[model samples]
Structure formats: structure tokens, C-alpha cells
Target: MDHSYLSSKESLDIPYITFPDLLRKWAEKNPNKTAFIFVDEEVDRYELSFGELYDKATKFAKALIGHGVRKGDVIALNGRNLPEWLIACFGIQLAGGSPLCLPYLQKKNDFVKVCSKLGRVKMLIIDPGSDGQNCQFLKEMICTDFGTNNVELPEIPDLRQVFLFNHHASLPSVNTVAELCSREWDVDLPRLDPEDLGLILLTSGTTNTPKAVPYSHHALVITAYNSIHLMKTSGKYDSLYNNRPFYWIGGFVMWEVNSGGSRVTLINAMKSSSMATAAAAVKTCEIIAREKVTVALLVPSMLDLVMKKNISLRLKTIVTGGMIVHSSLLKNIHKLCDEFICMYASTELALIACNTFTEKDITNTTKGLLSCRPLPGIEIKVTEDDGFLLPAGQRGSIQVRSTRRFNGYLNQNLPPESKETLERTGWFCPDDGGYVTEDGELVVEGRLQEIIQVFGWKKMFPFEIENVIKTKSNVSSAIVMSLKDKETGDLPPFAAIVYHPNDEESCESMQDYIRKEFNITTENRMLEYLCVPRGIVSFKQFPVLANGKPNRRAIRQIILETVDSEKYE
Candidate 1:
């Protein structure tokens, strides 16, 4: 593969701009152009224009300023991908304030915790009754309609004002969207610089409390622009999928699509009332086929569900990550799209490496792991535990320095993940462990901190085995963890699984299948022998942590008890 094309920023046809400034430019260039196609749960569709979106955003900015919002103040947007929610986000940013988006469906305690971390951060823009019911710290509540019939203000201290959008629920001093839009509260906003904090994305926080990652106006725009070039989309009318909610890092793809000045097609799955049920995925498929969507993104798990329905997606590029993609998924998903792209990323540093897989790249050797080509302006290094750089193909902790690095973590109290992992000179080593290919592609082996420690044995990532087990049609979820060997004090990994209730693949049959798949082979003995799973255990379902990752500790305990009570072959 040629390395020359990867070094040039000149290949990026789109010009980067501050996110707020881009809105202005788009409005001027294509006033009537459809910026968003919003579909409600009821199947109603709305086509908003660049001019209309900017007008509304400007109105909201004025309203925020009128209500005493200043530059650098925090404005939290909580909702599914609604037009008004994004308008408010742009409005806050245009008002010289920063915007932080929390998933609209978050529980009360989670919302409170995020607020607490920000140290009395007060403003919250929410969907009518989403997670705003119990955020006691919000001094002002901006509520938008998201299929809710009526809005109610729950008992919350410091939550003094209620601002409504597209509704007429009147209460004492409750402001209407109409009033805000037609108001004369105008102020001159300053021009934005690259260093201005534009967006704050919350991590999954699978291990601990969710941390806030702040990206500067420059970082967000540049990263988004880079995504377009990396994906290699044609110029105009190229439509990108907008099914994922904006709260996750996956949502950054939506911003990337917009930065390219292309179309972002939103299906019904992103509505506030949507649960992304099987029906919703089907609906999304229908839209993808109907619209001839050029690009679509999905997590590896979602690919399984989508493929089960046997939907043919008219997509040119399919972007997938979030979990190790099974071979079956890789092969089958390729049948629906032209190319399969796998990206390695984190919340703080967005896109690291991108690999576009063809039929040749779908072999068994690439099943559990695919080496992704490092993107332009991104530096990746495999370093030893003591910070020494390792040679190619030698496994070590993954560290990166890239344009996508966030401005900083929000909580000044808690030391940033960058404090230890990120050096003063600007390198960030995530907990992940992986090696690089001489070709400059990175092979990600799960997180080093999350790796199941097996004493004196080859280092193995649970994702490697878990992803393999997930390839089974009957397996709904799989978790592999190291259990304490009571006799020797050494740990060996065991597989815990949740099989489909209707499917009947027994534990014995599963064990036989695993033993056969990983049995002694004729060639590459090291490769064959290293693929060992010590034991198998069954679970009804995997316990999930607060941030939606598998509760590994709980799964290990369950597996440990199974190992203790009975001896296995």
C-alpha cells in the first residue's frame, strides 16, 4: 500500500471552519439547502434548511444571552437527535458558551453525577420529561418536545425557570419557544478561535464515573473534516447515516458528515421515543435502501442484528467499531455493502487508524483483529510497560499523539487521564494494548488495564475470544475472564456465555466446538496453541455496568463459583 497518499492534507476537498462559523457559511452558500431531515416516531418527516437552522440557532443564542448566559458557561443538551436539540446546541455555542450533550434517556442519578462533576454547572436543555425530572442543580431548564404530549416540571432545587419549545403548556413564568424566537434580545457575538471549547463528550465510564472530554472548536472541525477524507466519499449528495444518538463518540460521525457539506439521513431510530427495536433497525434498513445511502455506521453487535433480518443496504462504505467484529459478521456485512471500514478510536482521541476491508481482507487470519492504517496527522507507537518503544509486531501498550486529542478533561478536581498517560510533550497512552504492522496499520488487542491477567502465559485479550464465541448464532453475549486457580494462585481465563433461550446449543457442544476450533493445528503452532479457552460457564444474561459495558467483575464471580464447585476436563 502506498504511504504517500496518507500524508497529504491537500486531498481533503472540504474547507474546515469553526462549527458555528460553518453554519453561517452554509446558510450563505445554500440557504434553502436541506440541512437535516428529521423524522418523528409517528413517521412524520421534516426538512430543515441551512438558513432556517441558522435563524433558529441565532434566536436561541439571543434567548440564552437574555437569560444571563455568558461566554464559557456550560449549557447541557439532553435529548435524542432532534432538530431543536441541535439548534439549541448551536445556539449555545454561538452565544460563546460551551455545549455538553448527555443522553436524553439517562437516569436521574447519572445526570446528577455529571452535573456534580462540572461543579454546579447549571443550565440544562432537555426533552419534555426525559432525564430532567431530578437534576436538582439546574438553575434553568430548556425543555423541547420529543413526542411527549405535555411537559411537567418536576421538583428540583435551583431549577427556577422552564423554557418550552413547540408547546403551549402554560404555567407561572414558563416561557414559550414562540416568545424566544420573536424576542428582541440581540447581542454581538465574537468570532470563534480554534482553541475555543466547542463540545464536551462524556465517556462510557465503564469502570468509573463518566469523564467529560472537551474538544476545541478547531479540534472538532478538523477531526470531522479528516473523517470525510479518511472515508473517501464522493463530492455531493453523498448521504451518511444518522441513526446513532449524539451522546456517544459514534455520533461524531454525524458531525463529520456535516463537515463534508454532504447529506446526513436520519432514520426513525434516533427519535426520542425510539428504542432502536428490531422494527427500528428494519425501518432504518428500508430508508438506507430507499435513499441509496452512500455511507452507514454501526457497532459490531448491531451488524449481527441487522444481518439477521437479511436486509440489503445500498451503502458504498460501512463504518463499524465499538466491539471486535466476528468473522461471520465481517463476511456477511460485506455482502450488503461495497466496503467494510474498521476504525480504532477513543472518546478523547477520535480516529486513530482506519482499515478498509475487501474480500481478501476477510480471511480467518483477520477474523478477531484487523490492522487499521493510521490516519494522517495521527502518530501511533507501541511502548513497553516502562515507556520504551517496541518493534513492529511486538505487543505493547498503545500510545497516540494526534490532532483529535481533546482540549482537556472537564473536571479540574480529578486528575485527567492524560496526566499519567499523556506526557507534557503531548503523547497519550490509553489502557489498550496492541502492536503495529510494518505497513503502519495498528492491530488493537483489548485494553491493558482490562486484560485478564494469566500468570506466566501469553498475553490475551478477552475480546479476542469473546468475539469468536459471539460468531455463534445462538450466543447472545459472551464474556471471558481470568479466574483465580485456588491451587496455584495463578489465573486462567474462562468463557461465560448467554445463549439464546430459543436456541439449543448445549454447554458440552459449545465446549467441543471451542476445542475443535482452537485444537492443535498442522501449521503455525504458536498461533494455534495460543487460542485456548480454559473453561466454559453459562449465564442467563451478562450484568452491565453503569456505562453499559459488561460487568466483568460480576461475570468473573459467577464463573469462579462454577469453577470452584465442579472440576472440568
Candidate 2:
């Protein structure tokens, strides 16, 4: 049941081409075919034809050259899921420059400090605000619906110029997107090298600071192509619904359109104001039912909200991940959607594995991590600390190797240990602990580097123990960590939880349950020791970190000072 593949599954082969070449190919054939349908906040959907998409990108590329944007320059793009974002990105690559695709930020941080990591940014094209409550307020004050206004940038030391996308707003120094589309120029596009840097994607800093991962033109093209092939989605789907601005699947669909390979309809759920909301469950229902979206990918954070919604869905597949999904949440997703898949990936290693679930999988009693087969061209292996491969079902370090990996980090001095770790060919050890099933499926336990070495007979992973506690009554969120027992110098694990309204569960009750059911009878020595929490604490809500994961390290620091909560006895 781990890695199921029918003998009839066809061998996948993805065609690769550079951005300019792909655009030209699509524009040449079926010029009138719709390339993308962008749904705006006002519920109006605008269709951009293949010819129009290519022509606009070409004009923008020419305008970039006219404005001193040269080959090998670095330009940053900040916007929502709009045609303009794609236009600028393809234009940057067509002009032989690298486009740094930044996520839409609500609040402006220290610009000088943030921009320093980008090296020298030749120009910045940004949507002053996108579509949502946070963006609505900003858009009302700063930008037109088209996202442009003549406001001073936050003084980025390396920023040369800024461009906004509103049709009405104009500035002497700043350029409007309307001008970009029709910036009169007649110059032949520069010859692009496939190996030239095309895009820089920042890592989602779930555990640490984000790093810039550079991807070459051919690498990105092949990566996107391979992704679609792995999804096993043939022909055109009804509409590809996506919650986020940029997901790997959506990128694959875009590349499919650009490469003239497929013409599946794309539904950016975030574009329609009614679909994207500060709340999760209702928005999920609205986007799917309203758009009749056939396929989509959401994150595990949406589970709490998704469980509250009851609706009939036209969805073919619902892919979710980026955190461990509880079986309870999976039940809600399973009943609402046809197919459920868990996508396991990192910014460093894109799309490592995607495991589809079955009816039996829903009720399976195994508390271990879910299983997924590695992508066709990618290799996954389990290894011990001694640099040797481990047998199946034995937890060890996880390693992945593929040709579609990033070129390297933008800032070479990042992660300091990366040089030593990736010193070998294409193989990347993510430092996650996992075991391969006998069926060749990979199971990720958690980050081995982040595992806690509690003072005991065996060390434990906080994620494994935390997942167990989350199954408790009325628990909203749970975090497990180790605290130093000062009297005996023993480091016993502590469990902290936030409860949902109504069903009252206290620390004393949680500890008593664990001590009886876990500490007394479990024959598995490791499980018996790890599951018994030495202490339990309750918080109304967990403090969130930069990238939205619970800040366990910060919470541990606070608990160390207050109350004699570290005692195990």
C-alpha cells in the first residue's frame, strides 16, 4: 500500500524549452487560443490570448532594454496572481535577466536590510497591494485596482528604479505598467542561453531564515514540465484552482500553457475577493463551488477551517502539505473532495514526493508518518549518520538527488554548512529522519537536526511526540520540547497545548492520561519513554514564527524562567 503503481502507467517524458522559445512556439500556433483567464477582485475575468501574452512580454522586454536593463541583471517582481506578474517575469528572462519572484508582503520591513540580501537589484516591479482584507486597506489608500501610485520606495540601497502597475498613476521617475505594455521599441530579442539564471525562489523559512535558491532557465523549465507529468493529469482539466499566489503545481500549469503543451484552464482562487479570505473553511468552499475547480493544492493549516465546512465539491484532486496532517482533518478533506494527496517538498528540494490516499488509508491504524513515492527522475534514500544506507523501516537521514535541483544559493555564504553538505554531486541531505517502506515509499518523521536529545535512554523527535498529544481532547495546538531538570541535570520532555472552546482539558488531566496509557504498558521502549510527557502547560494560543510554524524555541525560553514546571517527578 506504500508505493502503488500499475503496470499500465505510461512512461512520462516532458518537453523542455526556454521561456522565449516556449512563448514563440505558443504564439506561432493558435494565436487566438486563450493563454490565461485572470479573475479580478470585482468578479470580472479577463482573458489573455497566446499571441497577446507573447506580444506583451516581448514589448516589455524591449522596453526593459530601452530603460538600461541589460543581460544578466537582477530584477525583482512583487505581485499577486495577475497577468502582469507573469508578463514581467517572462520579460525579465527574455531580456536575459534573472527575475527574483518575491511573495506579496503586507507590511514594509527595514527595506535597506531586506534588499541587501538581493545583491544589486536593477529594478523593482511591484503591486502596491493585492486582494484581501490586509491588501484591501492598502489598495484603498495606496493603489488603484490596477495597483499603481506614485509613492516613494522605502530607500533600498541597491534599488535603481521602481515600477507600479496602475493604469492611472504616473511619476516622472517611476514607470507605470501601462507604459511597460506599450513602451514603443523595435529591437530583436537577445539570444538566451539555457544555462543562464532565470529565477531566484526564496526558501519558506519554516525553521530558519529564508535563503535564495537560483534556478537556471532550462532547469526551471524541465522542473515545471516534470511536475505536471508526475501528477498524471492528462488532457485539459476543468480548471486548476489554487489558493496561493505561486504554488509549484500552478507554475507547472503555466509552463504547460507557455510551452504549447497543454491549455488547461487556471483558476487563481486568490484573485476573486469573494474566494480569498482571512478565514479558511468558507473560502475553500466558495473557491471550489463558485469556480467548479477540478484540481487544487492547499496547506495543512486550512484543516481547522475545512472541518467546519459542509459542501459538495466538483474537485478531482485536493493536494495539501507543508506540515503533518492529522487523520481527523484528512477525513473532512476526503469527504469533500475526490482525491487527497500529501505533497512533501522543501524550497531547496522542490516536489520531493506526493502520496495519494485511499479509503483504507483513511482508517489505517498506523500512527507513523504517511508514505509517498519519489518522483520519476528524483532519487530518495535513507542513510545513517555514518554515511551508510539503512534497511527499510529503519529511521535514518533522508537524501534526495535530481537534475532539476537549484544551481546554488544566491548568497554563497549562506547556511555556512551547505558547502560541506552539498559538496558531493547533486545529492542533498535535508537532515530529515525517515524510513523507506518495503514498497519503496518514503516516510518523513521530522527534521533530524531539530530532534531533541532529552536526558533519557533514547533521544526523541518533538514532532512524533507532538503529533501524539494533538490527538488529545479539545486540543487546538500542541508543542513538545525538552527542559533541563536542574536538580538531577535530567532533560525531560514537556508538552504545551492550546485548547478549543468548551471541552475543558487541563495540564493535570493530560499528564495523568499519558502516565497511565503511555508510561505504564507500552512494550516498545522508545514509544513508552517518548510518549510520557514529564510536564504539561497550556497556552491560549501559540506564538507564531516568521514563516508561521509555532515558535518552540522561543516558548521554551519563556517556560524556563516561570514556575517550577521543569520538574519531572
Candidate 3:
């Protein structure tokens, strides 16, 4: 591959530092400091120091080499957050290979799609107990706990070894692979370039097909820089705890590896309302209060639940993203936490823009509309429909250009020349309808694609309805969509609401309020007797991704599957 396209802004050329180099620097500085702390069911507490992590990673690298794992080999870590997950990631980098972090919730189709995209993965290091026995490519299985029952392993022609951390003394071992770790290796591992691929992340394809986004070592460094400088996180002052999965970019870049040498506390459990309840019940709140966790990243709904429940967690800074944060919810969050930072970002551009709330900024109705200046190494621009760059304060498609931007999607066709022109300009037309305020803040409207035409008049943005619904006391979260009307040949918008289980009356009141607020008079409306929601179906709770973002696509699918279309107007 030609490397001449890369350039450096400072002495620290991003493309020059690999993951191993970064880890080595941190280890040298904080040799005895704890790098990761995880709590497992069997092993109550698991911790690893910088020196210990480095040593283990070095041994794992040698183990891979001994098993014929060569440079550019694709390795997969397919399980929940654990010490071995980080170890496997570092080991792959040290052994000059790319590690693909797989989501624990992936089913048959998702798994098949990922495997196909990651063609011919050389090795797979999975948690045998957590991952179950359905993996298609199980070259090596490692159980972090010793007492886990040894189930029948999957049939893989390339499988070579199984290393159990706690049960290595009694498990049925095999040849061609060693149960030994870094404690047994005295040899040094190979190095990597900054441009070398570090991890392969699959983009969240809510509106379209999923694409594999490959991040280089330089890109990872840029993520760390953004976290430290742009987000203003300090190791000396800030303690971080992240429950997000290690697979997604938001989790991996923002939570797991962003702080460099700072300690990261991981919650190794499936994410759900029950899990949240269990965590709160276990006095995790007390632990957080004791540790004085200054910075945190939580999903909006989860934050709402935590705040509503009055969990006494002392947090100085709380940043919410990965989904839209309602104005009402934003204000409530501000009252709960010392400092609240609301951000809008995607995998393509790690942390595009964030709103750091001042006391005055918090009370503004435009609180959710504040525009953020591009980070040090990034550039942003807005453009019109004709592809002309728009000046400040003008509403147009927003585009971004950053040194941290991903190279391209794997196994996916590149956008056309016309589309490429839009992308190269760094003016991402997020297709979100919103204008930059006079104060240079970006106000995100609803998605341009989601706008509906009702009776030839453009109806309100879905976000508008969602925001309004969220203001209703009992409504937890809401999604509004335009449903087609068969009789009138018009698209009328309807809302699917998720309310507190006991708030049936509140839901009915909201329906009445919306009908009057939107002025949906029975005489003028196409469906005279039927208000908007031809059918109202309630869900126990909305599906949420590991990163705390609502699984809108999944929820939409569930709604479509459960409700009868013919019943509605």
C-alpha cells in the first residue's frame, strides 16, 4: 500500500504510532497501575496492571505466532466485555494482525454477514461460556473462568487451541496449541505502523445495509486525542465507568480505550432494563459516589431511569449521545448532574460536535440546538442542495473532514463520483433538517428522509412529535412515523409510544393532547372518526443497543410485526 498520502501536523505524526506503541508508552509510565477492572460472575473481581497487561499481551502474541498466525491475519474477539477481550485485541496488534470485535447480541444473519465481510479470519478467540457453541469459526476458545462446564466445541477445520484462564489445570487440552500465556514467553513481539489496521467496526445500519468500517492505528490515536483534548477529560481529575459494549466505535473509542493510561471500569453483563435495575440494586451507585466518577457516558433513556430512581451517583460531567436527547430530558439531566454535555456523533466522524452547557445555556429552549466547533484536527462545512458551500448561520447539509475519519467501508462499493464530491468536501449533508444558529451552533432537525407529506402540506419533523411526546410526564420515549392513508392517498403521521408500565391514563391523555395541539379536527381530517394512531400498541420497553442508543429499526420492525396494518386509517 502506498503511504505517501499521509501527512503530519505536529511532531506526533498520527500514522506513525501503533496500538502497541501507545500501550508501551502507557505501561512505561504507569507500570504498576491498574489498566482494566472487570467483575465476572465466577471471578468476583478481575484486575490487570499496565505491566501485567503488556506481559500477557506479549505472550499471547507469541502464542499466535507459534500457531502460524502471520501478519495481516484477521482475528475475531466474539463475546462480552472481559479482560481477555482487551488482551486478544492487544495481542493481535502486537502480532501484526487486525482484530474484529463482534457484538455479543449478534444472531445468525448478523453473524453470517460479519463473517462474510471479514473473509478468511485466521483465528477466533471467544469466551466459551458467554458465546455459547454456535460460532462458525472457532479456531481457539479461552474461558476466563475455571469452573465453566466444557461443552461440545464447534466443528472448525482450523481450530487449534483452547486456553482456560481459571481451569487450565483440569481441562482436556490439545496439541498444536499451548495453554501457556505471556508468563511463558521471553521473546519480543513484532511492531506495527500507525496506518496498519487496528480494528474492524461494523457500522450501525438502521436505515441501510451494514458496512464494515476499518480503523487504523492512527485513527485510534486520533480518537484518544479527541477524548482527552476535545472532550476535556483528565486522568488526574476524572474517573470513567462505561457499560457500553466494546464492539461499537462509541464504546471502543470513547469508553474502553480513550483515556490512555487512565483506569476504565467495565460492567460485564447484558444490557437491559433488568440489568440496570440489578446494577442499581447492587449499590453500584454507592461505589460510583465513593470513587467520585467525574465523567460518564450513558444512553438518554438509561440516564432518565437513573435520575428518576434517584440513584445517588456523584458525577461531575455526564455526556449523552448515540440518540436524540429531548429538551425536557436534557434539562432534567442538567439538574441531576453537575455538568451535562450533549453531543451528536457517528462512527464516520468519532466526535463531530458537542454542546457544553453553561448555566445560561442549560435553560435555553435551544439547549439541544447548540452547535459545536470542530475539534483541533477536524474541519466542518455546510452545503446547499446544489453543492455550494453555505456560510455560517445558514442551514444546509453538514459535512466533516477529519484526520480521524475512517478510510472506507470493507467489501462495500464506493459511493458514485457525484456522491464522492459531497463526501470529500467534508460537508456532510446528514439529511437532517436543521440550520446553524446565529451563534454558530448546529441545531439538528429531524431526518430529511423521514419528513412526511400530509395532504400536500409537509407535516412536522418526526423529532418534533417525539420531543413533544417526551414532554408528557409518563412517556418514557416515543417514535413518530408517517403512515400512508389508503382512502385519501395521503401520508399521515402517527406516533408509537413507549410509556411507563403503569401510565395507561397518561398515554390516553397524551393522545388527546396531541389531537388538540396539532388541530386534527374530525371534520377536516381525511379519516374523520379515527385520530392519528389508527392502532396504538404498547411495548414493555424499547429495544436498546449496547451503547445505549434506541434500536429504532428493531422497534419499528417489532411494531410492524405486532400491529395489523388494516386496522389503522
lDDT of each: 0.64, 0.62, 0.59
Q: What lDDT is reached at residue 398 by model 2?
A: 85
Model 3 whole-model lDDT (C-alpha atoms) = 0.59
Candidate 1, residues 316-399: lDDT per residue as tens digits?
A: 888887655544566666677888888877888877777787666666444446667677777777888877777777888887
Clashing pairs in 3: 146-167, 371-441, 371-442, 398-427, 398-428, 399-426, 399-427, 399-428, 400-426
- Candidate 1: list runs displaced more than 4 Å: 1-17, 129-173, 176-179, 253-280, 305-309, 326-334, 359-368, 412-421, 483-491, 494-496, 504-509, 520-569
TM values, all candidates: 0.82, 0.79, 0.80
Per-residue alpha-carbon lDDT of candidate 3 for residues 464-557, written as tens digits (9 for 90 to 100)? 6666566677776677765555666565556677776687554456677767755777566653223345445566776665334457677666
Q: Pick the candidate with the highest TM-score.
A: 1
**Higher-scoring candidate on lDDT, 1 or 3:** 1
lDDT sort, best first: 1, 2, 3
For every candidate, C-alpha RMSD to the true structure in Å: 5.6, 5.7, 6.3
Q: Write the per-residue lDDT of candidate 2 for residues 1-569, one digit (tens) a residue.
A: 33212111233465556746767777888777666665554446677777887788888988888777888888877666667777788888888888876655523442233456667777777764543332333343333323232233334444556676543233333466667878788776788888888777765544455567777777666666655654546324445555455422334334355334323222343332222123545555565666665666666545444554443454677777666555555555666677778767776667677778755677772456666777656777787776677777677788787657643677545344555556655667776777787776777777775565544556567776776676665777777766666676555677777777676576678876766655555466555455666667778776654333466666775666554754632
TM-score of 3: 0.80
In model 1, what is the error at residue 7, expressed in angstroms?
8.1
How does model 1 fare in lDDT?
0.64
